[model samples]
Target: MTNAADRIAVSTWSLHRMMGTTYPHNLDTLEVGPVTEAYGPVNESLLDIPSAIANHGINRLEIVSFHIPTRDKVYLGELKSALAAVDVTLQTLLIDAGDISDPLTSDRDTRWIASWIETANELGAERARVIAGKQKPTRDALDLSVKKLTELADGNAGSAVRLTTENWFDLLAEPGHVNFILDKLDGRVGLNGDFGNWGGPTKYADLRAIFGRAETCHAKASFVDGTLDEADYAACIEAAEAAGYKGPYTLIFDANAPHEWDGIAAEKAFIEARIG
Candidate 1:
């Protein structure tokens, strides 16, 4: 049986509080400079994150595109080398930008997203998680997302990295839209199901409805008063497991809990107790 440590993955976003820097190149504004905040001075390089997380007994790392300092080949090569040094895996390159569902920007954004997918391949990541769409859920939006995403899948056919869309933004807000787009893609694009993206009483059912198709998961748990909401987190993992999901659970620690790794440990333990 896989242990909690083996099944665990960490998103760089989880450690944003400590990462201390942001590469604005991938942000919506397209600014190309580094931004260091007061909370986290520019103390660490992105290259150092692998060995840092590896020290936590977690080797699977998912990087948000925005966190990358540059697309320079030398830098990317160094990053890949760093991962190999620590025996860590680049679980996914999260292309956290673009909206292919909008008519005005569809073509441009499709090209932009494709470039990030190429970056994913260069860094030797196993997957590239792209945003499907953020436009209101309309039939036209879904159709555009399907066409553009299928094209992306085809474009990545010969590359080392795979493609996955998330249950995030507006396009995949519900199970019906999620299934419709996935059905239309016909297995060309994969799913990166997120636990906290969908809410309401139907959250668990919605997770069960689509997690069966998930290739990976964002095991995000809710927190109240800086405390881990154990019941909510347990139910989310239970729902995913019930739907036959047996993939790496990427721990997403967004809220400023007592400690980032502490929050991650709590999540890892819950998943281990549930299905690890």
Candidate 2:
């Protein structure tokens, strides 16, 4: 009975173009530069997102922390109730922006990340993701990541949610450094291996190397002028499976579709057909 559909989840970031700008935290707020210039203002509310995912045949979801309009307990309860009503699992709470690499801001950023982890616990997410870093993978930066991530992980002990990081940002672009940080953490943190974050000729090789340690995957497909690259998409799946990655394929649809839901459904079908 188990198949790829059972292992699929959807990320709200995929529908960033449609998720209206009601929430205070902008997706581009933490980026190095203004990158969301092309996307339209948010058009959807968090209250409506859960049912939307369920309607698409996906029962699991990974929500970007910023997309949440409020941290009030009442709102959080509402979101939880909505998901429970439809039997959807809040798989992961993605804490999108934080740079534990900068010593000057490490204290402040780590505290911020810890705050999100607490929210993830309150929201009943199974796991939470924090960005690894934006700095180069230097010894000092890696050491700083170890210290801050350990602190954040230790705080989550005895909580239902586990902490995770992606093979994302400049510091974690390579598998060697990715392993270095994970090995140093010694299972304290998990990985959210992202297919689109890493690219180039060696992308597949890199994915295979790091995905074995992945607790989940950001199964993103590359697009050119709104067209999906089927070859690369399949290869990313193959590499992940080859490395024994058996976690949920968190579909991240970033292409141009008339309706965000249609783009998400198309991705789910693509994955199901290949893995079925």
Candidate 3:
């Protein structure tokens, strides 16, 4: 059996600083066009990240869609090969853009999101996580999201790359909305519970509600004055355990100023101490 320390995973989001660059190529006119933004002349190549992460003793990774500079098959194949070389598993390919809840543009966004499933397959990822919606919570909006999400799941029927949605953005800001929509989907789509997405005194209780169905997790810990909020982090972990969640805890570390790899290592050490 895999030890608890072995269950730790990393999300490329934690290394955004080291990456120092991002790609904005996707559908959805919610903001801007696919114009390339300048951040890095990249410090490290995406293909090299697998080994970098492996060096830290993490064998699983969730990649943000934008972090992947291209959908080119050759490049995708090279990334897959890099992961194979290090024996790192691509836990999930996170499709961070698009709002399938918008009635006007959802049709276009749905097609755009579906296209990435092929890309995930190319990278040999275990799942492709999509944003359920960006619209405000309402019966019509939730139902529309469910329809689109179900369509994506059905459209990819029998795909080895499973489909997942997160408790994020306006549509799922609350547990009621999350459970409602996932229930509506009726197992068509799975959950990727994110610790930092929802906040408040009720965060722990809310986590318990949705994480029970979570196939993966985004274990984002809060920091203040450059210190980990161990209370919050511990409670979040306890909540997930209470919900009976058994999945990789993908660490997410975004700081005001970064020593991203250091922040990640700190979080990893905390988790390993508790569950190792």
- Candidate of highest lDDT: 1
Clashing pairs in 1: none
Model 3 per-residue lDDT tens digits across residues 157-220: 9888989999999999998999998899888889999999989989999999988999999999
- For candidate 2, lDDT tens digit of each residue in 1-276? 278778989998887777754343433233223224335665666778888888878999899876776777898899999989998999999987778898877887888788888889989999999987889899999999998999998889999899999898888999999999999999999999999998898999999999999999999887766667789999999999899888889898877653667667767888888777
Measured against the true structure, the TM-scores of the candidates, in listed sequence, are: 0.95, 0.92, 0.94
By TM-score rank, best first, the candidates go 1, 3, 2
What lDDT score goes with residue 191 in model 3?
93
106-129: candidate 1 lDDT, tens digit per residue: 888888888889999999999999
Once fitted onto the true fold, the runs of candidate 1 whose alpha carbons sit more than 4 angstroms away are 25-39
- What stretches of model 3 exceed 4 Å from their correct place? 28-38
Candidate 1, 213: how far from true, in Å? Answer: 0.3
Q: Note the residue pairs that clash in candidate 2.
A: 19-42, 20-42, 20-43, 20-44, 21-42
Candidate 3 positional error at 30, Å: 15
**Whole-model alpha-carbon lDDT for candidate 3:** 0.87
Model 3 RMSD to the real structure?
2.2
Instruction: Return whichever of 2 and 3 wins on TM-score.
Output: 3
